[model samples]
Target: MNLKVIAFDADDTLFINEPYFEEAEKKFCVLLEDYLSHQGLSRELFTTQVNNLPLYGYGIKGYILSMIEAAIKVSNGTISVDFIKKITEYGKDLIEKPIELIDGVEETLQALHGKYKLVVATKGDLKDQQRKLHKSGLGNYFHHIEVMDDKQEINYQKLVKRLDIQPSEFMMIGNSLKSDVLPVLEIGGYAIHIPFHTTWEHERIDHKVEHQNFSAVEKIIDVLKILQ
Candidate 1:
């Protein structure tokens, strides 16, 4: 494949992440249950989150803020301060949640670690991402860690340039086709998609990918066959 630097997305790719957010979201919906249906509340919360993206960027902290904002909106300013506090606590609990590595994650990394110049090219709050990586006990597998604020074509371009590798020499593995696969493929890099059970709405796309460099696998362990 002529790949030298291989990157992986952090959140759902390496370990469990979406379910934590989903669980927190359920609590948030219940907090506002008196105001709206759970589905409606979830929609409102997502709208608030998307609107606040530029101000807060992407992270659990911003998500907490979105929940609070949405709660206030849904409750028409009648939501109690105690409930707001609980919402904040939800974000905290998420941050403190244990690292649960995806099945076959360690085995996959163990096989590919030294063979490839591995990296974590992920998007999120740097501190939280760092904490998760530390907790995962998979730190030594990577040659470098890039906890970027976002992952897009330009961002991937800059990353490739910084690493001094040609676009074609880079490979990315992740669950999100929007953030991880398309962008890397846009820059002429190879990307392998390892789908997770839950995907955030913002990370979802409708079109099918038709790139020679793009591939999808059934699980993390399946990556071994393609890369080998």
Candidate 2:
């Protein structure tokens, strides 16, 4: 397979992300453990985050807000102000947390750096994504960085245009099939789905589907084989 530009997703793909959120959420659930069962609280929080996506997009800020709303809902407005503050603090800690590179990420990027026109095309709050990238010490590897507002087909199409590469010559690698794989494949580009250990509710797909241009690998290190 011939490829020109290779776009990689940031969270979960290159560094530890979903785990931090999952840990923070467990902590949040504990705060509401007295109000409702942990499983019930988890379900409500997931629903709130899904409904809030249009307003907050994606990031720790929105997540904190959703947890707060879920807390208030389950507690029926009797939750303590101190509880809210704690939730906010959790969000702050998550945002300030260091980026832990996924196993083999740096080595994978280093191997592919100059061989392909590598770039980051991740979706998140621009400020948060930029902070993570720079701190990850992997910034020097990419030719371009795109903090996408979303990863729909139109966004990927615009990216290909900007790179001056045809759809067949462009490929995107990421964890979420909803965000990274299907959209790129929709626009006639190749995509690789490298599933993370944990996934957000919104990123889950209803069924397993396959396409000629869509493939999956076990880890970032396996990307070298795909590129070859």
TM-score winner among the candidates?
1
lDDT tens readout by residue for model 2, 1-89: 78989999999999989989999989998888998898999999999998998899888888899999999999999989999999999
Output the lDDT of residue 198, model 2: 93
Runs off by more than 4 Å, candidate 2: none
Query: What lDDT, from 0 to 1, does candidate 2 have?
Result: 0.91
Off by over 4 Å in 1: none
Per-residue CA lDDT of model 1 for 120-139, tens digit only, reads 99877889999999999999
Q: Give RMSD (Å) of candidate 1 vs. truth.
A: 0.9
lDDT of each: 0.93, 0.91
Clashing pairs in 1: none
Write down the TM-score for model 2.
Answer: 0.95
